[model samples]
Target: MRVTRLLPAAAAVLALAGCGAGGGTKAVPPTATGSLESLAAEVKCRPNMQTDADELRQAICANSDGKFILATFATDRGQREWINDAKDYGGYYLVGRKWVAVGDDGVVKALRGTLGGDVEVGTNHSSHSMHGGSAHSG
Candidate 1:
């Protein structure tokens, strides 16, 4: 009967829809390649500040050699202005310089303008390439 044929088609469509919904989505695992020394250096060199650079540097160095989690970058005017006014405090990396964000396990979760624009993560790895995006083989 036509009902039998239509039932199979309907079931197939539902199954296909379920599969499609589940597919095409991936998780971005945390990275573990960050250094506190680099972070400190960035804080020390941050522009537009009225704090005791040397003291701040020493304090940051004291806290160096540890792991951190969750980091973000800013490519907007507001964020840049905030960094300038805040003297680069807190636990965020300074962009426009080579900086990286690490996870609790010390992996590089995300990278910012350190590599320059026009590049994304998981790309190739060549010295000539920006953002560490270069072709590789194993």
Candidate 2:
């Protein structure tokens, strides 16, 4: 019957529409990657060199958003270690593959628009004396 056929066609159309609405429009991740200067430029910041070494490059940068510390590591291990130690101070970090932007939450979130990184929040410890307690992992 015409009614039976229309019902199945309508159901098929709805199913296809649901697929597109749910997962077909996944946002593409930001792929911008580069050195301290290039990344800073993308975010419209003038970097003031802080540390220049074989293992890492760091700079202090400021823009209309705010000031932030931008650092790039020579290796993934180096970057992770630096983040682990720095997390004790409690701050917001916009992290990429080999680089990280440390700043207040607002500034860090603003940086993510241009830098395309994950926002990580550091744990703030009032007392540094954890003694032998288990370390917190993100």
The worst-scoring run of ten residues by lDDT in candidate 2 lies at 17-26
Give me the runs in candidate 1 sitting further than 4 Å from their true place: 1-65, 69-75, 88-92, 96-138
Q: What is candidate 1's local distance difference test score?
A: 0.27
lDDT of 2 by residue, 1-138 (tens): 111222232223222322111112234369568898999999898988867777778777778777778888888988887777667566777889999888776676667766777888877664455786646647
lDDT of 1 by residue, 18-130 (tens): 21111122343232232334544443332222122221211111112233221223224432333343322222232332223221111111222222212122211224544
Q: Give residue 17's lDDT in candidate 1 (0 to 100).
A: 26
Query: How high is the CA lDDT of each candidate model?
Result: 0.27, 0.68
Best by TM-score: 2
